[model samples]
Target chain A: MGGDFPRGKSAIAGLATFGVGEAPGFSSMELTARAALLAVEDAGLRIDAIDALFICQPDDFFAGLSFAEYLGLSPRFTDNNRTGGSAFMSHIITAVMMLEAGYIDTALIAYGSNQRTNGGKLATSIKPNSWDAPYRPLFPLSSYALAAARHMHEYGTTREQLAEVAVAARQWANTNPEAFAKGPLSIEECLASRIISSPISVRDCCLVTDGAAAIVLTRTDRARDLPRPVVPVLGAAAATWWNSIAQASDVTTTAAAESGPRAYHAAGIGPADVQTVQLYDAFTINTVLFLEDLGFCPKGEGGRFVSGGTIAPGGTLPVNTNGGGMSYCHPGMYGLFAIVEAARQIRGEAANQLGKIDVALAHGNGGTLSSQATVILGSADTL
Target chain B: MDGMTGGPEAQWRAALADGRFLLQRAISSGTVFFPPRVMEPGTGETDLEWVEATGLGHIYSLTWVSQKPPVPPYNVAIVRLDEGAQLMSRIEGANPETLRIGQRVRAKIGTQDDGAPILLFEPTGH
Candidate 1:
């Protein structure tokens, strides 16, 4: 992988999210169209100006074509690349490549899901693995529980540490009005919650909600003409080692170990330079594993690193400022929200906005800790 | 032999029916993998051979499924076979609450509700 691939080549000019918690009487496509139109409007561009479309819906086949048709778009370039939750981050990489190559002028990445109102079963198009199907491990929760169990056994990570993640997320959520879970959360409550899977209480899991998010990407020069600050794509990279948890060589680690460094190298920045981070917190263990894999802390020290309000408000590191999927909203795929929140922080427009965020990191995880994608975005000064 | 049929999975099922557990080993790289694949992962070696597993390994990770009444809870575990391959199976003949990671276990072929042979595990040396 070239270190300079698509570095600072493109910027996100506009982003919008619709149906964050619940949007009754709205189909996934309708939600996507709503967000897409809002994003184009935010960029001060007409919907007809979107020359490229990137989308992935769990229920739709050839989602890009369906979304393009739904929005009355005949984009010259379209991508329906599906890596589960991390697909949106990967879309950013592809959009940057197309923009830098002059294949397309403006690109839109969109996603939507109605998993909550339509019942909380994962609306994934993927069939169960023949080997794993027989065991009936609860889809993704059990896979994450297995990793949590292994992490505890190997590193002696206490349950208190896991509870802290949910607590911190809820604390952040209390500040965001759009957060689905906006109540005071304590570590004791998280530890006492009903166990959905061993070591993973109901509190540790992300919300099941209806939502759609879209972001528009264009060349940095064109983005400069837009009203919003140029949140340049400083770096982007993705990696996938295994699709199943049983196949992972080490359950305690994720592919973020591979994607994180590559993205950082592309951006010419390290973890130290990041002012805030938005991690795909589908499960509390995800934050622990990703923090270690992304070089925020040493391996096996993630449990300790996140404890003691380290990632909470008024903490050393501000994480998931939009309340994360664990509390804010998780509509099947949560990666796009991470990017959306990162852009908000970079543009100084976040609801729980931090001060002077020059650089921010957004990490996305897909499948059962399978695919990992890292996107490092920065203000124009960083370029 | 129960008339071994279909692909690698079918062969694996036949072996389990005969009260034997088997895993695949790549002939070229000597890497072992589970769930019976046509080609070796990572190495893409098609020339693979089946070997009888030791049926002895430790629990790499374990989780107990808490079910409502009328359906009893069970344990789902990833066992690291001594052969270096890992597979998801349930631990039987032991209290579900007592199971923990890193505990040594032995495999046993148990019949499921459908009368199909399935792989199971029980704590060893107890």
Candidate 2:
């Protein structure tokens, strides 16, 4: 993300930031209300302005009703873009598309589920798809297993480097009370944290806590009359490979390789322009894989790029500043939060802000290791 | 758990003959969903209708997995079928030596013990 592109305050006239919301992990309804209220309050708009509704959680036990009826979202455009973890971003991407096509403005994107409070039964009972329901790969854990095995087999990546990503996120999480994976998780502790999948341990996986977050996207003309006068959708792109985990061409690469370029081009920037990055970390391998796929480093060198505190706080391109999904709370809501954090960082409001507020990248992964979506956010000055 | 060959066996074979292994869902206007979903993705309606894929496709990208992966190494790829649907499946029936980007492939039904079918792509020899 290099170059100070052209951007004006008018370009983001309708932008606003809904205060990030979390709820008492009782049920999906509570999380929904929690996020909706924050979004409503943050935008300084009434709950009724949301003309578009998108939800990633498409299961009954979580939402307590069919999506449309459950949320009471009476929007013209609706999407439960369940591309996977990035479903939230997919929802946001859909909103942006609708806005560009003049489909609708003032859309509300929300995601909330309880793996911790709900006894983790919703995920276990609900099968991902017809092909996978039978196999029932532990998903994030097993999918990371595929990448762990590939990285170890191919690039001579050690277990320690992968652990570093988790460790760094935890260290940063201590500053943010909402993060689930806080506390000092030394490499030794991580190495011993119950091998969920080979080369990756329990801590390497996202926590099962329940939380909800919502963002309000309005027409550029309407953002000026909001709580946050800035923070607009700068650029977004999505890419998908066939979703056969076992049949992927390269475990180390991802659809981000394709999506990242498109997003950068749309934003009129390059990888180097990003000051912060919020990579989806349902598993450490994804964070690691995307570091390369998004052009942070050359292919097959993600392990190296992440080593030696390059992505840690006070390091070059400090990533996952708000603890990411690994330490933040993976509850499948990390995509929205990651984008939220990137927006927050671009606005210079993160707990661990590093450099000048310019460009930030948020990448989300979905469907076994195949689908990917990337969005680039930048400041008006740098735009 | 391993795949067994039984009742899921017979029905799967017949479905393969009928070319029912091809999946269609609402997730996209692009390709078949390998793992079928009850809903047509983007549409909340449970309007998922199964349709037979064109079965004819070109090799968009490929790799020769040298050894067993989680199960063992095998050839895997993203095949762009004539319907413009991209599917990721094991590339069987052709030697790795002769694989090319534009290689024509035929959809093959892989049957398991329980009579369920798994679709795998194989290169159609010229």
Candidate 3:
């Protein structure tokens, strides 16, 4: 795979988010359409200018066709790949490829979900294996719990270390005005929270909120004329190892180990060059797992690396500067929001914006640490 | 029920009713996998054979799921069998909070709500 084909060739021209915290009276389609329209307008482009559409709607069957019909667009190319939350991150790579290959000039990647409003009933739940379903594990959650338990057992990662992830996210959330859970959070509070699954408390999980996010992508040359600062797609890659945690070769590690290196290689940069990171933190353990897998620290050293406000505000390496899904908002699929925050950090428009981020990394995780996708975005100066 | 069926899952379920644990092994790669499939994973080779499991394994990973009032919490675990095949099951005859990873376990058949036999594990007490 020529991973560098789209490096610095494609750029995100516009980004928009709607109904992030709560969209009580809106449908998922409505949320998606509104965000799509806003994203087009943000780029100073009309609705009809979007020649390519990439959408992943968990609640809708044939999501691409349905979204096209709802938004009244006849795109020349479309993709509705559903790799869980990471689908949008993977879409960024696809959009870049389409733009570079001359298949489409403008790509609109979008996602929306009303899981919170629907009482947390996800229309598409990750189906456990037949042998595992009989035991009635609380899917997705239990899978992560198992990984956390194994991580603790094999590497001596303490619960306090795990709780630090939540504390850090909450600290960042306090500064983000659009964050849903701006209230103070402490490692003590996290440790004392009721256990939803062993080794993972209710506090360890992400907030369920109704939200939608969309980003408009075009060639870097065309992006020069767009309204916002051009955040070019420097590199992108994705990988999947297993469908269920039981089948995973190593529960403690994720496919990010594969995707991260490939993405960094494609971008012609290493982890040290990344000023900030936005990882898909569906659970506290997720951040720990991704940090280690993405080469932020040595393997099995993530727990120690995140301790003592390292990833918190004023930390060494700013992570989840937008509060992340754990505090900001997680509407079923969160990859789009991760990309949105990465762009925000690069554009110096994040609620908790860092200082002059030249390069940012946005990584997405899907299923039970199953699918992993890494996207490296950089400002014009890097190119 | 007779242990006779055209599909792998049916055969496995019938064997469970008779209190026997079975796993599929790929003939080409000599690799064992769970949730009996028609073809081996990765290679997709249809040449597969059923073999008796050792009924002894260690807990590779585990989690205790807490429920609302009146519903007791249950343990969900992944057991790595001695034959090198791992599966998802529950540890019986022990408190979930007291269990630890790498603890030895022995397989036992348990019945589900509809009287369908399910494979479970209990502490080996070593």
Sort order, DockQ high to low: 3, 1, 2
Off by over 4 Å in 3: A1-4, A123-125, B1-4
Question: What is the number of backbone collisions in each predicted candidate, taken in the order shown?
Answer: 0, 26, 0
Pairs of residues clashing in candidate 1:
none
lDDT against true structure, model 1: 0.90
True contacts kept of 2: 0.02
Task: Give the top-scoring candidate (DockQ).
Answer: 3
Give me the displacement of residue A133 in model 2, in angstroms.
5.9
Score residue B114 of candidate 2 by CA lDDT.
78
Q: Write the per-residue lDDT of candidate 2 for residues A1-383, one digit (tens) a residue.
A: 64222222122222222222233445665565567667767778777777877767634442423445665766687775667777766666667667766778777777766656566553433343454333345544555665666676678777788888888888788888667667778877777776654556776776666676777776655675666746765677788885666546566678899889888877878898888899888877887889888998988888888888888887787889988877777665568778878877766767777656778888888777777998777675653
Q: Rank the candidates by lDDT, best first.
A: 3, 1, 2
- In angstroms, the error of model 1 at A27 is 1.0
- Look at candidate 3 and tell me the lDDT of residue A73: 88
* Candidate with the larger DockQ of 1 and 3: 3
Model 3, position A162: C-alpha lDDT score: 89
Q: Model 1: which docking level applies?
A: medium
Model 1 chain B: weakest 10-residue lDDT segment is: B1-10
Provide the overall lDDT of each model, using Cα atoms, as 2-decimal numbers: 0.90, 0.67, 0.90
lDDT of 3 by residue, B1-126 (tens): 244687998888888888888899998899988878899987889998889888999999999999896788889999998888888899998786578899999999999999989899999979
